[model samples]
Target: MGVTRERAIERLAGRHPGRRGFGGSADPAEAAAFRHAMRGDHDLNPGVTPPSTALTPAAVLVPLIDHRDGMSVLLTQRTAHLTAHAGQISFPGGRVEDADPDDVAAALRETEEEVGLPRDRVSVIGRLDTYITGTGFEIAPIVGIVDPPVPISIDPFEVAEAFEVPLSFILDRRNHQRIEREVGAHNRAYFVLPYEGRNIWGATAGILVNLAEVLAD
Candidate 1:
């Protein structure tokens, strides 16, 4: 019907390496659309080199869990007191540490730390796209399949609650809203996926949009 667990796994497994297995990979139509959309107007061309400005390396696990009907994406809401992204809806992840081998490792490690979803419980399939946020972080969205019934132990300091949204709901283009909003001194177009009264926007919503594009029939 719509975005079943088996179909999602089959789809992600088919993404051939674009750049080192994640960057610019163009399988399942095309990848890294974020590279163009996320860039400043001055850096519009695909060939334009990235600016020298620093973007902290970060990774997020886009966890998909199975259900009798279809798959649902696992997400988290940050605690209100956190210094950054407080009380926002997000995936289970954080900044990539130097000790980590790569983005995948960083994503899994962060997922484990933030939500207590052990690394072994997740079966990584592929990646969505590398998204660089306005906050100066280069994010790698690692797509993975998590078996259901796994215990969740959240770190209260970083996470307020863990929840899931049906993948079908996310993949449906009808729900993806692009709004022009004024920020500081500039107006910017951003994606927002509103679910069950929760405002899912920014990079987290962007990553979900990419997944929807990749898995669309």
Candidate 2:
């Protein structure tokens, strides 16, 4: 939290845009575009100081597992020893590399490297707005539908564990909570998705909110 904390704005989850079928359709193509794009709300978290600092471009894959009952979002818990975002739940991704062709490639590559989820197993459908983090990262979130029954291996160095949270649970406004705290001279406010005992907050929560808005539209 920083000087830019604002009241929590939870977008209501409703009918899915472009949904041709009824009852929780997991159509990746239908869930592509959002009515309005996200701007990495400054009031949510004023990222680095001097706003002029060079930002590292990154990408993450929002893996929607196509389960029989419904879809679930695949997320990972970073190892506590990591320098950045230690012990936090996050999407499998990292800073975009020069060898990466685009955001999609970066996301898929990072996901494979971090969680061993093959690109072939992922049906990349669309992308969400780029989210800028307080740590000076420009993150592009790529939404992909993953076919289940695939064995996922985790990178012990970076990822501590991998788990799936139901998409329905995440989209519901009743589950999203706004938490605030005083950081130095600023009052910081951010979204939190507390599932079971897991605390999903910060940029991760922000990205989920963006996804919820897109699906709700």
Candidate 3:
């Protein structure tokens, strides 16, 4: 069998030596190989960080729903009126508040505040490397396994809609696209995974690419 839900959970539960910055490969591999490969090697996001900006700290929950249909990822579409990342597909998270104890606390708290996913319902497995955004935020993506059928009440002020994407679709490297854009005087490349009608790209897509590398098979 390929990577089973149980096996994926088990792998995620293991301790990973935390890296300073975010990085991962998009190449598909068997789960056993992928797990080992993630321990010491991955590709870092290139040329996205601006030289003059100070990066703010942020955290996000990479929520994996353990459903009977199949493993899926929960995502959110931000409201169009927001000032930052408006109308974009993203995880339920934001900049870490001073009251937050750590990255895990920030992730779970934001998940609850943004999407009504109670912290108690989430089973945090581990965290991915820190992703430094061009806009100047160093984000920690926390991987969590969630129980199915839990009620979600998304905050209308921040989230326009909430939806799930099949893990199988995202785990496939072929779905990841390398896209580029010119910001001011610089051109930068980033990852994009367009699903159905939603365009999942930038930091969200980069984190998904890291997840695919961590769990690919």
Among these predicted structures, which one has the highest TM-score? 1
Candidate 3 TM-score versus the reference: 0.82
Q: Whole-model lDDT, candidate 1?
A: 0.79
In candidate 1, what are the lDDT values of residues 1-217, reduced to their tens digit? 7777678878888664233323244452233443444423213223343333455778899999976777899999999998898999999998889899988999999999999999999999988756676666777789988878867999999999999999989989999988766666766677889999999988888888888988999
Query: Compared with the true structure, what per-residue lDDT tens digits does model 3 show for residues 3-102?
Result: 5677677667765645432233234343223333332111333332232334477889999998887789999999999998899999989888889988
Model 3 lDDT at residue 2 = 41
Compared with the true structure, all predictions reach lDDT values of: 0.79, 0.73, 0.77
Model 2 agreement with the true structure over 1-217: per-residue lDDT tens digits: 1110011112212222321111122553322222112245354655523123445778999998877677789999999999988999999999889999888899999999999999999877677767766676767888888767856999999999999998888879888898888889977888999999999998889889887766652
| Ranking of candidates on TM-score, top first | 1, 3, 2
Worst 10 residues of 3 by lDDT: 34-43
- Each prediction's total of clashing residue pairs, residues at least 3 apart in sequence or on different chains, is 1, 3, 2
lDDT of 2: 0.73
lDDT of 1 at 193: 96
Where is model 1 more than 4 Å wrong at Cα? 14-52
Better of 1 and 3 by TM-score: 1
- lDDT, model 3, position 98: 89
